[model samples]
Target: MRRSELVLLASFTLGLLTTRDAFAWCRTTTTQGFVPTSEKPCDDTGIPLYWSTRCVGFSVQRDASRWIDLATTRSVAQKSFDAWKNSSCPADPVSCTGSFDQGHPSIEVKDLGPVSCDCVEYNGKVGNANTIVFRDLAWTECDGTPKSDADTTLALTTVTFNTETGEIYDADMEVNTANNPITTDDPPGRVLYDFQSILTHEAGHFLGLAHTNLPQPTDKTKTPTMYARYEQREVYMRDLSNDDVCAICAAYPPNRSAPCDTTPRRGLALECGGGDPETTTKSGCGCMVLGQKPSGLDAVIVGATCLLGLGVVARRRRR
Candidate 1:
């Protein structure tokens, strides 16, 4: 198949976006309700485009040790941190580096004495420096700072890119169930939120992905990596879809496109509109469309026909 054709077929198999609403969230774990109807791009100034080069890291700290076990909480945070590193670091090691790895540009988790601030603040330290500190404030004890609606839940707040300081700060808090478990849309009941799931989403923000507005009219409906919702049963805080990987790759295509054989492989079935390949047209060629298995014979037939057409063209040219 032609390169473009191969890409399209791959996209169809992987299920590319068809409509804007496809990216919208049905619900959010935060009290802010669903993400606001805003058309903000992931990074207005384009800093995220180079974020991978800057080195992504985090520090988990606790203000007080009351609500949950510090060891358990740190373990959970580490799990989430590792998830981000594995998926995002393959392309840019500097930006996706974590404390576990022996790197300078990394995230650090520190214990601050108590759960004073809203869950934690990932503010860009040293004037936009890429750093995140996870502060677990045992409960509703504000760190002398007044709590606003924005700070109520363990929400990711303030993604600032400072050109002067060359730093980026992103912060958020962890929900403390010491007093009463917060109610959320997730299945756990009582403790409405899932720590890992919420952190995974926030980490995406830290990586510079914006909230997906309802996809454009021509896009498909699928769960996006940046979707503004939390899955109840999800435990790993770091999980990314092909689209997410594609976005990061596009932002930082290696100095040169890696040879096709060198490209990392993925294992998953690529479905388009819940239909077989015969009914779908290939979209684009990139890492986003690789390794998607077709679900039916129709898809195989479509692929075969395309390959045959290419063969015919090659023969005619040879003659």
Candidate 2:
């Protein structure tokens, strides 16, 4: 019926610490979760929130951007996924200088081909995979971005999950081609939003990674990809920072194992076909009815009759 709130406010609201200093990465919390535990620890505060499975699925919209061809778009998307997939600890803390030689494995990010529509859905009658879509026009889908009514968001990642088990079912990304000039190649003097940079950032959210509130030191070149905001042509966002890799590895480890179906939310037919896929999963593993978009995943209150908990972390919030 409605979409859930994925905007994270903590990243901006809190004053950031230096990279040498340890800080917290914001996670989505539901009424049932966000509790306290050493294993599934919250921040200094107690809140248990993390993706319980690996092998997340995502799809790209068929209508390619005018600035880039369909093949180029998909290629860039795959490269973004690989950036995180290849991330490890040494890159962090300056090549794991402060940490040991423990290695983190990569999570599987499946690429399901083109589709007709680029809107978010949450009805049980149909099923869809996590999606990456391009909006060449104004963003009108979910009443605009989480921060305001105006269209200022460059891109977003909306994740749906089961509050009861902290299991994510669907995660989708939408890039704002209407507001920002997105491009694959760099032009002299003209600043353009790099597709790979933003895709890597959004993919972190899709894989259950959260934004870290830590600020980059004056001499630093790049912070975490999960940092709340990024500057145009900031290719540093294309890769995982130490914090980005650390939080992700902690949440969904490389060697971590689970029962996951990496299959696209829609089958191959929907991938090659030029239309939206079926919305319902007979086994009900894809999505369920939420009725309305949630306000904030971390602050959601679970009522007596509330359905299973689903966590969402939107990438557009300034805070």
Candidate 3:
């Protein structure tokens, strides 16, 4: 049965690919329960998260600071994690409907290479480090200076889980040079800000998924990269919708594929100086939970005179 594998099994029974579904998340508070006490994470009713971890490492930050360039930010963050692991299902990633390829995704994203420190630290720790950085010149929001709010967030993803066992451990993503203008180059109108369509909506919050809404009414001009914000030379939030494939098949469904060890239980090291607080509390860790977006606010606002220079979340549109 190989007429090109029966035309790839009739393109998966004629769904004709290019698909996605409704999905939403970004919340906290766990001990083995849903999270969403709502203060932010772009809170619209946050309470659907995943990543019980098997391996995660997205490192990048090798002195290409304040001007952005270090092999085009690690080649568009590995094409935004291969647009969710090549949209799964080579042999049935749970019948792969996509949206981070539904469940038993066995969480894997290791390339954990470069490092000169791009902190997302969780100091109450023993393990951490999952990053992606770019903030040339300057840009800080989440009440840490540099337009400390009032809309202008182009990109920012931060997740630090386990208020009781949602277990994320760490997460970080920031992109937004000073004020605007960010690129991965696909030109046409060139208003910039399409670095792999906001690194695939910050890799859908680096895999805990959230910010979805744009399925029932048809009035969002354009939504779902997890749905929060996108517009301005708008590069179509780089795919995934059907409510983000029904929110990763209702949080990691995909018929439980196993045998994993993606290798990054939590990593970080190129030098931040460690000397054993148990090997710096269990190798390369960091997380603070201050995210920004195209300005979709699910988390931010912490100022008692906090101002860094690089620590971002910008791109505010959807009002």
Candidate 4:
């Protein structure tokens, strides 16, 4: 399916925009049922897929010699990449091992040369340039003239990822350094956005996940982590929730239907109380049958709520 269509399907299934959190519902769709072993995309269907394949490598550059501190820029970029790698492959044996068994790809960043609008063309597209060069130029440099403008204007002043090539390219132009010491004063650090956060989000896109939007047009509620716009410093792209993990696994399940052993694997219902709904419901009903009182009240409430909601849902389904 097209990327846009996938995003729409995800929004519809989750009933919310919180993409990562709501993706848990995606596995419930009948269409997502087991692909015939022969039709599995990866060669080794026995293993779950890994994130390594998404981010193959990165290229970093800045304008002019003094435009930015190469050391600091490189450090932040490396840290961001490492954070994403570690998150994808935690030290834990269970999580790490399972992901590794899948053919996840790895990524590395290189210092490409400086960029100049004089020799290059900016079509407002990224990944078009295999090498990202930083030019000590400003927007005015590319305004009309050529040679004189090259030294003043910056080109491609944003960090963008090419989904086709799995490459991250950043150009330092007209970046607001303000309080950012790494790129303020002196030559000025021209990073367009927070390096760590933007990379994190772009990495998500590289991993075969698409932007998530709010399910209800009027809801005005933000979807989960995979939401298109970046709003909070805390919601880094590197962080993966239970829903994220499940989506990856569902898209690439292990051989022989090993079933994820971690907490609340796919196919399990999410309880309102934050535990397994199936277990909670079964136990709650058992308690009621056994003449339990106050303790069972919570379960009773859950059951009633579920029934009422289910009735409404069922009616809607019928219609």
Candidate 5:
């Protein structure tokens, strides 16, 4: 299958305007840009993408990144997830200028250690792993197909969900280590891509968030973690902005009743295939066959573009 068919590309052409401050968070919808028409319109428009379960398991590729060690990769991944997992609603509206709602998100992220498979895939017939992989050699689909914008993309998260209800079934994060120099150094002397900052932003995408649009002339310090573009050496995206907290709280409210299942939808497969070899399914909401694209479900691919001296806006792409 072609790379375009595999994942959606988040273009670095910011055209849509996203809200900012307390109520500026936007969720990934089955139908992109679907807003309900009402006088008292709700932010929860269309079928917003989300996980039904409270506990989600994320696994790191065994090989990790060529730029960073396996241990460091695991550590950064954990910290990135923690940034969102431990987020709480704003206590004081005055102190927190972007306070959106009350209560913490009822979600837990667990590290399932390293897995042999670095493929970005979701299997419906057998077990699956919500993997975090680094593309040290090339950026491609699970079948090793090169992405169209691999040279410009810093990271991308592919989320498979039920188009009818917008329930996310599986999500896999892929970092572009081949074209970008990913670093974990704190306050680096030179310009290098911060791993934690990038992953934390992608984690938000993993949790069902799209690139937040803010009006021009807004506070630059308060840019949401879900903001589309990267700022090269900046680490602000590593921590959750007040707007980021609002996004989490809005999606997974506190005390929400959900079972903690760390395992992927069907089960857990260290590798990719667990079903037929020749058959492939692209029909929204179906299982995938080896050497074939996913079926029976619609997948959304959100990406963060690298700031390689180009001033472009990035937006989520749907498939």
Candidate 6:
């Protein structure tokens, strides 16, 4: 199937958008079975996916992008994560009336430098890297197969989580510099996609947020950072709106007592294939050789992209 068709199908299968408020901020969900009868805040489909930890580490692909340098790419990435990381949830009382103040989201993003693996992958039994790669060559599948929306997709994010529990294991982002002209310019010139805005939106997906509104939103002021589409030279998504803040805060409420460790789960795997030698030793497990997947895993990969026509890249079933 085409990328767009696959995405539409995934949306329908996963139920595209789920929100508690009418403003349209939604968290990405995966289905295992049915919701429980008791009201422990269960999603109707299955479970809402989220990072179970307070600190998350992300790495930029070592082969950054042909269009932009590695230093700039890394810099833009930190700024993008900061757009959501630094947001003040529940709207400060000073800015708006009748609003209560809540602390920032209970999450901290750390830059784990660059890695050799540009592919969107998650290792169940071995080491893995939460990566942000730029496809300056072509927008193809992880195995190099051509994608139907190669020319249209701006970026994509792949999130791996336990299907049974909705706890995210790893997330990787791929930017379509192959087809899109990404700019670091403040206004992003005509038809040039803003790099910061694109990464910020992808970061939302990396953090387990689905699009705020499916069919285009009419309220410009309420247009969230998680909106599924991007317009030419549009940089508005670089900042989080009220809806975006609410969604993130709801997913990760401020908890000062939460442990803050900025390490990628299972340590860090820098290469595309096989685990990091150090990581493997630390975890006391063998590295994946020749791209072989470990057996008996219950994890599923759910990807949410930045622009329209991007699909959920892969969903690995149990072996």
lDDT per model vs. reference: 0.34, 0.55, 0.50, 0.30, 0.67, 0.66
User: Which of the numbered candidates is closest to the native, going by highest lDDT?
Assistant: 5
**Winning model by TM-score:** 5
Instruction: Give the lDDT ranking, best first.
Output: 5, 6, 2, 3, 1, 4
Evaluate model 4: give its lDDT. 0.30
Model 1: per-residue lDDT, tens digit, 1-319?
5999999898776554333322332211111111244563232332231242333434344332344455555555556545544543233322322222232222222222222223222211111112223334333324434332222344443332232322232333334343222222233443434555555555555544455544422332234555554433343224554344444433334343322221101111111112222233332321011122342422321110100000000111223
lDDT of 6 by residue, 235-274 (tens): 7778887777777877787754567776776678888654
Task: State TM-scores per candidate.
Answer: 0.44, 0.67, 0.30, 0.34, 0.74, 0.73
Residue range 185-297, candidate 5, lDDT tens digits: 89745536778888889888888876665443256556777777777777777878776787777778776899988878777778775432323333121211122333533
Candidate 1 stretches with Cα past 4 Å from truth are: 1-55, 88-142, 150-152, 163-192, 214-222, 231-238, 248-319
Q: Which has the higher lDDT value, candidate number 3 or candidate number 4?
A: 3
The CA-based lDDT of model 2 is what? 0.55
Residue-level lDDT tens digits of model 2 in 61-166: 7777777677887888888887766766433432223452456544767677776556654322234556677767565453354322224467766666544545
In model 6, which runs have C-alpha deviations exceeding 4 angstroms? 1-23, 32-43, 91-100, 188-191, 214-222, 274-319
- Name the regions of candidate 5 deviating beyond 4 angstroms: 1-23, 32-45, 90-102, 188-191, 216-219, 274-319
Q: Please give, for residues 67-143, the per-residue lDDT of candidate 4 as tens digits.
A: 45666555545564454344332222222223334422233223333332322221221222222233343322223
Error of 3 at 269 (Å): 23
Mind sharing the TM-score for model 6?
0.73
Candidate 5 matches the true fold with a TM-score of 0.74
Q: Report the candidate with higher lDDT, 4 versus 5.
A: 5
